[model samples]
Target chain A: EPEVTQTPSHQVTQMGQEVILRCVPISNHLYFYWYRQILGQKVEFLVSFYNNEISEKSEIFDDQFSVERPDGSNFTLKIRSTKLEDSAMYFCASRPDSNQPQHFGDGTRLSIL
Target chain B: AQTVTQSQPEMSVQEAETVTLSCTYDTSENNYYLFWYKQPPSRQMILVIRQEAYKQQNATENRFSVNFQKAAKSFSLKISDSQLGDTAMYFCAFMRLMNYGGSQGNLIFGKGTKLSVKP
Candidate 1:
């Protein structure tokens, strides 16, 4: 079965540095999303992207966060300034459309120091 | 706002036995979807099963089945003949049904229940 794939399975960055997490969603999928989970917390929604634009975002997806579908297959999440609290497992998910079940990637573990 | 709650933090079952994980959600929308995802030690989220709110028939996948109580806003997953491989963190999620006018479906996930199956 085709699955969502993310790059840099694990990422480590300085507190003030910028980092971009990349994902290649299933080729036919039309909707993409980003979610994060703190070490021992529930997975939290970050943002959703469709038609190359942001559809919705949460409070955690503030000024520092941005998502881009720079190409037909790549969906990327950029954090302008990484904070210690930003360290978490970031997941990329996609679905055929709004009514379909969203499929998740293995996740990228982001570590900030 | 929609929220998913999984009150059980941890549960254990003897190998080859059965287990059930509970989930509840707060959503006024009549149309939505509920799901159970399994995350193994690899930490990869895998969809176990899904249930559509409009469908009264419960969903079942092999040994994995669900008791979906639409009126009570509860969705529980039952794993029959549980095996050692079943040890993982299970998450319950909720998402609103997609509308025709370009609405995105975002999942609201519960905290997760850690299931350990012993031999």
Candidate 2:
């Protein structure tokens, strides 16, 4: 089965630096999403992207966060300036069509120091 | 806004036994989807099963099955013949059926239940 793939499984960055988490969703998938989970917390939704645009975002997805589908298969989440709280496991997911179950990637563990 | 709740924080089952993880959600929308996802040690979120709100019958996959109560707004997952491989964090999620254009549908997820199957 085709699965969502993410690059840089583990990322470490300075607190004020910018970082980009990349994901290659299923080739035929049209919708993409980003979620994060603190070490011992629930997975929280960040943003959803479709048609190369953001559909909806949570409070955690503030100005510092942006998503882009620069290419047909690449969906990326960029954090302009990271904070200590930004350190978490970031996951990328996609669904083939509306009302379809979503498939999730292994996730990128972001560590900020 | 929709909220998913998994009351159990942790559970354990002996190998070959059965386990059930509870989940409840609050959603006024009539059309929606509920799901159970497993996150192993690798932290890869894997979809275990799904149930459509409109379907009165529950969904089952292999040893995994769901007990969906639409009227009570509850969706629980039952794992039969639990194995060591089944030890993982299980999450219950809800997604509204709204069309956000092409493929992007937003999902609301519960806090999750940590299940440990010991031999």
Docking class of 2: medium
TM-score of 2: 0.97
Q: What digit string (tens of lDDT, one per residue) describes model 2 on residues B54-110?
A: 799999999999999898998999999999999999999988876543234677889
Q: Largest lDDT belongs to which candidate?
A: 1
User: What i-RMS does each candidate reach, in Å?
Assistant: 1.8, 2.5
TM for candidate 1 is 0.97
Candidate 2 yields a Cα-based lDDT of: 0.91
TM-score of chain A of 1: 0.98
CA-lDDT, candidates in order: 0.93, 0.91
In model 1 chain A, the worst 10-residue window by lDDT is A95-104
RMSD of 1: 1.1
For DockQ, the strongest prediction is 1
- Write down the worst ten-residue block by lDDT for model 2 chain A: A94-103
Residue A103, model 2: Cα distance from true site in angstroms: 0.8
